[model samples]
Target: MKLTNKHFRIAEIMAAFFTGSQTEQDERDFEEWAKESDRHKAFVNRLLNPEEYEENRRALDKFQVEEAWSKMDKRIGDTKVRKLSSWRSVVRYAAVVLVLLSAGVYYWWNGEEVREEVPVLYQIAAGTTGARLTLGDGSVVDVLKDRAVELKEVDGTRIVTDSIGIDYSTRETVDTAEIMNTVQTLTGMEYMLTLSDGTKVFLNAETKLKFPTKFQKEERVVVLEGEAYFEVSKDVAHPFIVKTNGVEVKVLGTSFNLRSYSDENSIATTLVSGKVAMFAGENSEEIVPGEQAVYMKETGKMDVKPVDVTLYTAWHTGKFIFRNETLEEMMSYLARWYGVEYRFIDEGAKKLQIGARLDRYNNMNPIIEMLKKTGLVNITQVDNMLYISSTE
Candidate 1:
């Protein structure tokens, strides 16, 4: 059977189900469906749990997502998201973010059903359950996970991370207290930070960055952890510098990737555009787009390679594209985005590898079916831990 747009629409409906804050009619429909047969209930459960979907034999369990979304809605609260002036100029940007946020993206198809096997690594990930944030000045912003935000006037920088696009607005700073600051977020999350000099940054999960809200004269600098992507603004006088996990990247006006995950044994900096010379005590050189600077956290050695930029930025988009990415690397992305802990009980999980592109925003089982269709691995779940057994 073939996967059709109906499944896509149903998946979107389930996305709304997982995250409360649904519309009036939607709630009524959910109630009606709940009163229906047990099979209907089982199908929804299958949709919620990717692991259950892969087996095709697991029975339904009470949905936990109802409680998860309820907690998320309360955490987000009545705080309003600041609107970006730039978004006003964008073409039809309002529909995408606003519509999807309140009611999940939807597309209905009146067609036949298709039930197909998924690829082993092909699985659906649940939406972010929500996260807590600690600000530099002890302030806290409890952001509902998966929700987009546009925050401006932070020490004079226009810092925003939205679906329209990651935009860094140029700002003028007049104070010194805002100079040295920190931006921190919890696990299973990511953010975009636009600096005063119009440099754009994307911060990954469980990341902490100590940066100046405003740049000092002649140099723009910051310290990083976890991962981030920077689109540096052009400034001949003030050079942008990023220090992370013992590696420093210096770029005048360029785009690059910085990985400083403390748990991982390596810090990687990939250049997507422009040029930059890295400084790591005597062993470093300049790099440009398609080149990655990987520093081993354990051995303290650097290796540079040319890579496909799409693989690095795919998460920024809705799809995870893998042109031969490793099994652990792929699972890590899913873990962060899905807000699930990767407890690999199977030591042989490393032997499993796959190459595919998955739009995780949709259904997980359909993706699982797609993965199994690849015929590379078998999957099982027990006690909320996913065990991936490699076939090859």
Candidate 2:
């Protein structure tokens, strides 16, 4: 049977369920996704939780399950991608080799030692929100906790929460030399870290930020891959530095977001406050608030432009914002966040673009809703692939 996009989506959920949701958090996550929309829930019921569908969990796999589903993200009348979901679980025969290896690779062939790979990973089950953090210390922290755990307390630092928001006091502290290193997030996790200098760092999923627990006498710096946001602490004596995809952001005190996902083709740095000097391996430009710096990996080229800062940093606010973005771009984030599979079956579908914003931790129906509004496309799921087609 031809795999429809509906079937592909159903299979992604099944993969999440079959992969094992042993932890209490996992169970809660499944429930959250299960209740997001009637379509999503009904799809889950018909192809996943039922015993009948469970009986045929061997037909869904085609290397492009996620991409395929991106093709058929819309719904078809009574075609029941749900039915294909159960029968197609076993179809992915060749996916064993294509692991999305984001971390553990050096930013450069002869890069610094700080770029070594960490062993732990954060995986999000399908359709749920929140992420698990794997620290370099071999400790795991759940960032979604109602109250964040102070893994350790810095001397002379205090946490103050008010209408102005929480403040970390840096009255005084000893300059004891501790092992400073990089911390990378697994695919399912994003993180927020406060450096010794009081600079706040926000990480996107599967990003690695390598920094010292304490600053060296010479500099305070961190390397990144994937995406992260920074609210720089003021320090005239030293500066804050963020490294990603071979580009560097040097600032004395500022706030910005760096997006350099491995799966993505470009490295983007958006400045929200203060100022930023964005330098590729060579070219340099200064970016102020409301501006962005984009780096293309292939040509080592860059473009610094002005944009809506809110759109660039919206992901940090638990929102996925897209501004005239392409369908492929949206699907990439979906593949990571929802942990769903896709099959980009429509060659020309890549030309379709969208501009929308939806809650990061919310159900995915909103994305589909916007897709339907475009009127240029149609979606259907066959087995584990979503086939998006152009009306023209």
Candidate 3:
């Protein structure tokens, strides 16, 4: 029988299901369709069986998976994008590769629990939700935990600390002198800061933001060392610029997220709303909402593309989201937030894709337990280091 577009779509859904990335509703739909007729069952069986669809598989060269994914992403839309929970699902056939890789099969998604067995592990301490404030004079103050203590006045800018966030609003524009202040968070900690110019920033764990206590008349520039989400206050006269390792993001009255981790390969600047211009070396690109600018560290080349802004900004909402992300990619975030070391026993395991969502503030024990439950990779802890290996 000649396969149509509908058959290809069903095959895609089947790949998602076997990889444990499909949603409960998707599973129900597939099951319902499977029970409808023997033809449907045979169709699904043909998809599941590698030999049946071998001739139909499209030839994809190295890195062509990303292109296929882009087409599939356009077809599926961002709403259905899910995080994989396991890496056990493997694709050996070329036809399955078209389905698997197009859906970002490196990230495994296990919708339901495969078994009731829980791995043996000690409860690890959760990350702290606190940050340290460095004044212009180089004095460090623990603001989150010690909110009651009176902080030293910085150029008459009152820094107020509440449970929700840290506010640095000036009653009057007293000092135009640029005195830089920094806020830093360690592993497993996050912070929210309101700048003197009313610009709000959310700093992620192991992140740092350095900004002026007072903004200059022409421009508002800040140096960032880690990941942060910015809500820039409208100042048409002054452009807000965030400078990181290889890129600079310029905005005016906009909200966006920038991630430039040292361990990561690229620096990603994701725009949530409004507009922003990203500059890397001589290259510059303007991106609007739902767009991201990725600056490759090695080549110093910047590429802008549309993205799901929510996934990039999920950290600000106290969540960690991985959509078609690899184990190495996910572990980099985990290592920073949990302050742990990761060693891969199998190199192939590092390339395994995973999709899942978990509370960022949760203890490492539960997170490790969930990964173990997927039965894709074995996670063992020795001191602060986590050893990950393919179960197969």
Candidate 4:
């Protein structure tokens, strides 16, 4: 059968799955497709077998490059091509041969000399769900998705941690005194928390949030050191307040994202639903849904503007949405989530603007390939560091 768009999509999904980057939805779709016929099930099983993988690799090594190139040339017209430099590149090309035996989509391999000068790019895995929880008694606990634990705070507040997240809803606070607890997520880690008041907070990588075991009768308040998306539980009498840097975001009952990393030049608060009032020093601004409040740390200036909230809030939904963000800014975000260091060899490359939406859970290979295909910059990995230079 001739390869159609659907076949290409399936191939892409298979590649993602083999690379350990397929999403939950991808797995479901793949399993559903594989159940359509016995042939499909057998093909998936063959791919999963270690011996079959070696056989496929050996077959790929003998694929005819010249004939395959001729066919590809006729399909896409004239196009310039460059020789791949390393076995890593060969493996990448070989991964494209999904359903090869049945679809007749040829795999091409040229026995060209390997170029040692070219850098080899390695895969960097995505972040996972984990955090450090510090109770009011000054005890630190490592909270991970795979583990389950139960603890009682000094204030008699009961905290339960399960696969979903840290839950503080079952409050058994005996003392009326305010007891503070903090949840911190390091680089390449994220976490979710259910506050005592039933509010849900999604903490991003490299973020820290400090809250009380039980809210005061007057108000609910939390201190933030990095970034988090909050869905505040509605309580008309007790307003929810998030304090970060010098800015304060106050909402009665709403959902919003606040980003205030120390390394970032500015703090941003993006409102997703309902209303929020952001205060910085003497200046205060109220932002409705689909709006953002930006507080410049250097200039002590606050500005409110309408924005596509998804660009700022997508992290809560497992996506990285960039809207013409500078390469330096984009890399900073990636570096925090991927736990990889990056340097721009060509200083000018740092200023290049990039606009794309990427799956936050995907490994670095596909993300790197997407960036390289943009023809804007060249990215190569050495150890855990990514060197970015101009395509020129």
Candidate 5:
């Protein structure tokens, strides 16, 4: 049968169902369609049984069998048939079959070669929620997932930690002395923090933030060393200031994203709401909503320009939105979040610009596949390192 848009839609629904992301309506529609023909029911059964599917796939031509085995060995290891406990494993298994079926169906109907060849990518899990909290006394506490702990500072400030995040709003007593604390997230980790003044900070991977357990009466100051999105509590009396490197971001009540990684050549502060003033040396600029203040470390000059704030703030919301970004820049972001390293074999490929909006919470295979579909670069992974080269 000739493949049409309807077939593609059905394939999408089937894929969603297998991945356990299908909605109730989609499940109902799929069931209704499956009941129309025994062949459809058989296809669904085959998808449900991974062992049978693997057996049939191995019976294909020599090249297909070898490729399938290679991918399976690299991704799933030596175990050919085993019970999968997570939807992620199911996605891995079903994704291969779905891609092959879709391609084969199109080729059989249209008699055309597949338009693109997708490389088999090794699974690299996405970042998780975790961080290290260093108390004022230089004692360190590991903040992990699904564990609850209550910590009391020497000044009687109560800090609560849970699976969601760390909260510092609760206090047993107020003190004039501000006890400084720090939270650091390594690669493959992101975390959220609620300050004593109700300001919520979302920290990205390989980032560090140092703040006092209690803000001083005059000002709320925090030191950031990497990237963070700040929703400053509306406190007109005490202005909130974020100090990073040689620059300082001053705001009373505003939301913005600041990126001041030591490795990056420039520091970017994108205003999402309210107003923020970026100050570096003698240079100062007050950026309004939808504007970005980029400070070049080399020249000590600050430039303000309008930008799509979502592009910079999307990571706080668990998505990566890149537009016309170089391959080197994009890979740097991915490397930190995925806890993986990448090397460009073709140095010229570093300058290739690409745009993509991907979920930061999904497995890295889909993201790699999307990059491969761009057709400008080729990616291959060995262990945890990804090698990128130009397709040309």
Candidate 6:
């Protein structure tokens, strides 16, 4: 029989089953198709293990994406001269085209073959150096790596772009209307900023930092929306304060990592050096180095506990250190940096706990492969969305 779109859909259903992401109805449909006829069963088996079809496997291995796209374009241009055949032929042609476009020969066709190799070269990549800077005068600037532009000269302070991030060193501390500036990092992007007072801020993905172009004499305060690692400059007279999500971190000449994502249940502040005081409404708590303060957004309650500082600060170092994190928790962090959507098939899969350290800068595919290898969870990528289910 000629290949059709039905065949391609059946292949996808088999994939979902192997990945453990198949719904109850999908499992029933798959089983019905398998028992329908001997030809259907054989086709499904070949899709499950493409090594059974040597010609197709070899064709996949030889398929070069760039050449395939060029050839497809030429074919499309010449389609008027040569009328295409039946829908079955079109489906077969489309299948081959999709296989070439999906990257890698093995993963596109065969499921078991993917088990032996790492498919980390995914379409979704990690965050890079880019941020939106809103200057004091209500003007915005896009700050990216190697894109240098002079922002402005507030009073005597000159805000300019350097090789890495924005730099503001030479500023006159004159009271020419206190100028407030905001820098925001979009999803799949991060940035570094050096404030006028030499305080360095390393912003994480989907974070925003609002500060003055030049700080007042009494205090240095910045409002944070998401997550950031701050290396506050030493000023005995002027204390540095970070306000975020109804909580504030007060410090003087210290470093800390603060995570205040809106989706999270609590705002976590981990001190790396010196000390930090976390305040929420009427309650407040003091935490020292190696300690974390978790402030619940709903109840406005703060709890201080000892934590591994490295786990909280690893994002800036191009690493993700998860210490016994749930599958849902891990995927939530991954989704932000990689700019992908994820869903668990069941509640059990979401709660499955695992511990692994991965290179945050790497693509999404390998990380999913690694998670699958652990036998804790099974992962399947449908377009940019990742579907996860319990291996049990």
Per-residue lDDT of 319 in model 5: 95
Q: What is the C-alpha local distance difference test score of each model? A: 0.56, 0.57, 0.70, 0.76, 0.78, 0.73
Candidate 3 residue 347 Cα shift, in angstroms, is: 0.4
Better of 3 and 4 by TM-score: 4
Once model 6 is optimally superposed onto the true structure by TM-score, how far is the C-alpha of residue 61 displaced, in angstroms?
24
Pick the winner on lDDT between candidates 1 and 4. Answer: 4
Candidate 3 lDDT by residue in tens digits, 174-201: 6556688898998878888888789999
Q: Which digits, one per residue and each the tens of the lDDT, describe model 1 over residues 1-392?
A: 23333333343345454444357776677667656767556656544453433232112112122322332334333232122222232212222221122122222112223223222233345454333444445665555545565555446655454443333455555454554556665655666656666677767667777776666667788888777778889898888888876678899888887877877888777888899887776768677789987878667688888888878766655667877667787777667666554433224555466788888466455655565566664444322334453433
Clashes per candidate, residues 3 or more apart or on different chains? 15, 44, 15, 0, 0, 5
1-392 per-residue lDDT for model 4 (tens digits): 32333444465576565556679888888888888887677666665554454454455445433433333334333432222222122222223344332123333222332111223345799999999999887989999978999998777778999888999899664856888999999999999999999999999999999999888768798999989999999999999999998889999999999999998999999999989999999989999999999999999999999999999989989999999999999999999999998766445679899998899999877887788798777565555766565543
How well does candidate 2 score on lDDT at residue 152? 43
Q: Is candidate 5 or candidate 6 better by lDDT?
A: 5
Model 6 CA deviation exceeding 4 Å by range: 1-122, 172-175
Instruction: Assess the local accuracy of residue 260 in candidate 5 as a C-alpha lDDT between 0 and 100.
Output: 96
Off by over 4 Å in 2: 1-144, 147-176, 181-183, 381-385
Of the two candidates 3 and 4, the one with more favorable lDDT, higher being better, is: 4
Candidate 1: residue 252 lDDT (0-100): 86
lDDT for each residue of candidate 2 in 125-228, tens digit (9 for 90 to 100): 33322344344456654445234444443433333322222234333565554444455555555656566677887676667777665665555788787788
In angstroms, how far off is 247's CA in candidate 2?
Answer: 1.7
Strongest candidate by lDDT: 5
Error of 6 at 95 (Å): 23
Measured against the true structure, the TM-scores of the candidates, in listed sequence, are 0.60, 0.60, 0.67, 0.70, 0.70, 0.70
**Best of the two (1, 5) by TM-score:** 5
- Model 3 ranges off by over 4 Å: 1-120, 171-176
